[model samples]
Target: MTNDHAETPPSGLRIPAEPVPLSEVARFDHETDVLVVGFGCAGAAAAREAAAAGADVLVLERFSGPGGSTAQSGGEVYLGGGTRVQKACGFDDTPEDMYAYLHAALGPHVDEEKLRLYCEGGVEHFEWFRACGVPFQESLYGEPGWMAPTKDGLMWLGENAWPYDTLARPVPRGHRPPVEGFAGGLLMERLAAAATAAGARAHTDTRASALVVDASGRVAGVVARRFGEEVHYRARKGVVLTTGGFVDDEEMVSHHAPLLSGHGKVSDGGDDGSGIRMACALGAATRRMASVEAALIVMPEAACRGMLVNALGQRFINEDVYPGLFSHAALHQPAPWWVILDEEGFAAYSARNPTAMPPDHVAETLAELEEELGIPAGALETTVTTYNRHAALGEDALFHKNPKWLRELKAPFAAIDPRVLARLAENRREATGISGFTLGGLHTTVDGEVLHVTGRPIPGLYAAGRASAGIHGDGYVSGTSIGDGTFFGRRAGRAAAG
Candidate 1:
């Protein structure tokens, strides 16, 4: 169960703030130009930018170090929409193209102008990271990445209205820093170092149990359980909620995203839907509930354990095509897919380099699937034969699998890990991704304002990252999340400094 891929809150989780006298009702522990709540990429960027802008910045993280889900990411920044990174990667993209792509991808569930501004800012933000000492090596030469398309396939041909991020024409636009090891992890290390160097004070090993609402109903600060004791920290400027999405909160997932395995455990206890629940308590209007989902990874450890069956009791898609979409395929098959793999498949996945070989390359027989997936003897035997037979010929003469994505294969279930689990159809739906979220918390303007339940912006408040909505739309390309974190973090920092 233990390996590099297993989820562990990134190191450096215990951050300390000097204690105050017990007599004081509130400690007002410290103050900053920008008070960033949740020290993930978004929060860290906000703190770093604010501090770099000569404003005292305060950063609070529930875990030991930075990197909410970001710490666990593959480090592929999806910076599309005419970003300098995009142009440098040798692709022609524009804000208009970004807006069109998202609109086409999401159909009616998107805001165009907000998305355009986000794209326009995306390029600048990427440059800012490099400008600020976070080294990002460009990936201009690699295999074509998975891209989504309109049912009509118009996104790649050129100018099409309402194009989604998945429809994005594939390009080598991703960038990573030169960290000797863990190519994706280096980015997080650099950002954390930058935040600390910029004089941003971060408190780790702290849990924000509740949001403090003043007599004026403005969000004052947070009442936290730190070091196993109650502590209060007030934000003089604004409280930015970059706590991240609720992937591991089983109760919340069951209540909201039912189609998925609601019982999935978070990498850490940090993502407990604290921000979402806090806003809801104060009457923050939540828009899409069942709509938004996250990257569902089926690893050795997960809550749901069962046999995946297809409509005709067969396997579909190259389940091991890529780690990102593997969970989606698991959750959305016409029927549950039968998990099939062998010792060789398991060992191959254990290797650090899995992309070199397909999951199917691992040998698996019908009997093996019967033991692993628990399907009936005859039904599973036929399914395995059909899958192996059809998959080898490079044609889904039976399932109509997308030819571009299909290849003949052995057992893919073991390509990633020896274990398997159930997921939601939305988890695989190309339109849904971390970029597809509609973040709404303090509803701060581009300048960052803490908004009331009625949509009135609170003075002395601001926000950046997925903590605020309308920053990203349906079709999020790579690198934009970090772009927003850096760009808006700096902007919010400057605004707070003023």
Candidate 2:
């Protein structure tokens, strides 16, 4: 994905404040109205909006190209309200409906009153992304996936839209692949292009090490270090920190977000809460540091990508479910053993993708199983016979595989079988990614004012994205994190421009 490059904060938590003249500095990187750290979705949104609002902007990125979490993400933004696509899909979606669902999902701390801006701003952001040249695949008529150019088209919200139901936030809320098939990343890419064309300056490999607070306690520009030396790039107006979560820093994450160690964390090794640390130095109030979702753990036995088997050696979820979700769910298994189901599971996998599995492999799965997969002939026959005899009769009675969805051992068999499938215990584990919903950030007003723990606003200190917490409350809705990145990034940019 080609995006206008944005500079990144220095790697790790090393924001050293060293003194060097502008000339002695390796590069003549000057200041601007805003300095945006991190180039992910949130940082991109904040920098672009600030520059477009007439601010001289300098965006920093640690990576070569733009697209932070967005680049690593599935690219689904969740706004619970009436969307143009939803109108076209003939499904009822409204801000109020989304609001109700969000409120229920997040409980009282969601800060909906302050969060109203997200709802009001979502339509504009969606349209804005579209105007920047994003593409949307229309669903077939009545198929929700087969809808029309009409505002009343049906939307097939993928797994990313799991929290959304048929109530207020109706169908067609998601943007189709912006490019040929790149999801939300396309929108971010477009914005990066727009930002670059607008003359927004950025540097990659240059890191923002420290928040330069003057002796008067007024927040000054940051001291950027590139190569081996320290180069100071000063921001006159303000500094906005958009660095993402610490998903890869095993020690840091284990300390802050223990539950997430196993999940497929989008935050690369670079997204260590550096922004959070810098903002906290300014006395920012962080919140909710233990929020976690299980990574769809993958079962090990299933060798190839096409044929996936669960504990019962059967396909648990729709094989078509985004592999992000699949991988996340699979690795969370209680035990190491996995089960590969018979012809029925293979058919489901095939339906999800015909090319996903080989035809010869799909047919005559039993004999092919022992051949392709080393299963003892005697045990294989015995296991299949037993499953066929009891599985359909509501008597897996052996494992008591939820009687609700048991099936007899049909024709094509699984390549591998689980020796033992243990149910996952819900108790807390030795490790977790329970870091709360992007808190420990500079608490800000809806206007995007960075505040101290004392509730006083810091001059020239602004924040957007996860770096600015509490706007999302203690719990976040499914699609809201990216949505917040877009919504509030713009909010901070607009405010900083003023």
Candidate 3:
């Protein structure tokens, strides 16, 4: 099983971004009706769906096993429109309501058709997860963070708390697996098991080096490297790229997502832009390549009780919005961000996490604290006075923070800088720090067919998950990644099988 046209370059054998001509292949080591690259959540779902659709499916994984960034996540699937879990939790949701909220929050260029389809198919997708043996409890955990405090199945993982709550009927859509800790590993394990039970064969430690194309420029197969040997696997139907994002690729990050460069990445190290590069070599179009999901992990509940101020000591965003939104806003503000908290707010935050780092600056009075933080004279005082005036009236006149967490800041104020840059200066990784992944990739159709820059679907080529920029546009909802991956992965597999 050798490709005479394939040559090891000076950099050694690597996944070629360019495609290989099928006429040069003397033999194929394996053959399948649908070939899936990268055995993460998307790959597993694709393989399962293709095999169940009566197609022979083969999955290639670069790692020793499955579970890419999906396993590193909190395992919350964003599902709405009156799912069984939602109904059991005594919450009413409709596809229209979900669509409206997503349309408003997803972006300046939201995918209307994909959003509508995702909302309409939410219930069916929930059922599919159940069929795959992914468990969901009926309980609801009303917490601030993405993951549920308990093994509860539902929570708010989007901008469903403050200003966005007024956009549509807010409903908890983050569906978590029934596990006490982070359920991402459990979720992927169940999905992979289901895929295996459905008769999908997976070849682990097999890195797809190049895509093979016929004379007509249609994708026909893949050339992979396994144990230092090159193997060609032919796909009679199509090839689906399910490899994760480009967050781990420094060069790619610096070129496209410069904001995320030098920041901590929330990836499984397999997201090296290989899949995206391979597709781009074939002239595949991309979307939102600059969009990223950066998380400023200051205790959200505690932040809601206090306030986030920039270097000039001015509030920019409502404290009660989703953390992802909060982080997005924080990144664009002036440097040296700080979370200002009073005694009560600090106590509440400390109770949530006892091991948190001490406050960066503390003072008995507002002016003293302002001086200690080296804020512009009278800036902190003016901001606090205005905030207290509105907070006392149970109203936020500026940013419109939720009234429930609003309170006047009195004497004895403290400030904590949660920026990763601040922590890195001290050579520490602890405390709340910025960590994120790239949210942009190849552009594809609803059926997961990769599209060209000219807006035509590439024959015999498909993609899903982070490999293809799907639902996310400008902003990200916590569970949407896993949700988008599994949902569209099934569609890609079924489409390729046909």
Candidate 4:
């Protein structure tokens, strides 16, 4: 199946190599103490912070409006470790625990210094967000799934799943802002306003074409295409690139992260890998470009209680892990995956999962389902028989699914693709069924200064959010992106201002 969205664009919009040297640049059309590209949460937060630090900041946004993929997100900020909200809700959390969990979740992608700074400053960052006008209620959601349908402040996105559950004292860290729907839009609204109020001027419909490097090898400004004109915007102090990742650029995705080729991209249009390419032109080093965060969300309650099987009809993962984690596993396994449930399970899930379409296959017995699915004569039957026996005993010895969700499958049987389950659940933004974005980008230090191949900082350049990599590795806990953006974005802005 050809994906039209991945078609190539004109050469002008194509990713660039080394930017034009500043000496070759004719004149500056605009100037600021600090220049920021991409007005998403990271850019907005960086602009606001730089402005507060007494730098004359200007932001360039590719979109006509403010929100980027952030607006299309669930708006859960992965925050914990004794935040005011956690304390107010009577849950005890510590930075040590949060650090431990993140250390495990991030795997080889972990930045020790950055993780230490983020965890140690987690509480203070939460306070800073509160001051920025983002609101959180002191409520908790006990159910296992994606973001709470309501405006509850706390829910479990993936923290309770193994091995994170055993890694730290598992607590609800996904803090959803108080918005009726799609809280990321609200977060962007408030933060964008905060940036403007902080005296940061934003130019909409502005796309950065290349970095402007001076003769001494410092990034002094940017060459941008705005309103169909090429203009030079000079930054006296520094330039911060927060233009997000390359998930939407099919060519880049295939080149860097081929595993994500078949999945749907979950980004706004601005994430085209141009930022990373432009930075790389100046010798910026990047890491983990192949790491993609695929999401598995909004599984029906019955689907939650059901089991997933690959082509061989064998259960491969615990049913209760974060949907994204499940999706990652599923993608690695053979395709044509199915989530099998019984009539009882469907009945339990139907009301909660109102968006779910009818099952792809429904049959009076397991044999009939296997025949319809074209599986070998008794493979599914044998798998289901073993699963039921173990579920009846409340013990999943093979995969260790939580006993509370374990149940025997009795006829009539129903089977649906796990991919369909992700698409049907329409409670969140960006992606519903299994959708994802790239998690890798230009490498940077803890202070958000972009690094070179020699492990040295490129003077006067910094990056944050998806623009900089090394936060998440193979798996992602929800809210980490927003949390990372706001947290490290501040550091980048401040570093640039200095």
Q: Write the per-residue lDDT of candidate 2 for residues 340-436, one digit (tens) a residue.
A: 5566655654564433333333436565565454444444555566656775576554433334335565665554322211112223342232122
Q: Global CA lDDT of candidate 1, please?
A: 0.50
What lDDT does candidate 3 reach at residue 333?
80
Model with the higher TM-score, candidate 2 or 4: 4
Give the per-residue lDDT digits (tens) of candidate 3, residues 175-287: 99988759999999999999999999998878888788899989999988877889999999999999999987877889999877766778886688788888888889998
| lDDT by residue (tens digit), candidate 4, 1-498 | 111122234744683556889998899999999999988889988999999999999998877767788988888888888887787777889989888888777665676787778888888888888888999988887676656777888877666667788888877777889875478888889899999999999877777878999888899999887656777899999999998989888888899988888667778755788789999988999988988887643363544678887777777888787676777777788666788898888877776667657777899988898888777788889889999899899988787777888888899999876555555453333332466888889999877899998999999899998988847777676788888888999999999999
Give the alpha-carbon lDDT of every model: 0.50, 0.55, 0.85, 0.81
Residue pairs in clash, model 4: 296-323, 296-324, 422-432, 422-433, 423-433
TM-score of each: 0.67, 0.69, 0.94, 0.93
TM-score of 3: 0.94
Clashing pairs in 3: none
Arranged by TM-score, best first: 3, 4, 2, 1
* lDDT (tens digit, per residue) of candidate 1 on 246-298: 54555555665555443243233455556666655565544334433324334
Error of 3 at 38 (Å): 0.8
lDDT of 4 at 413: 91
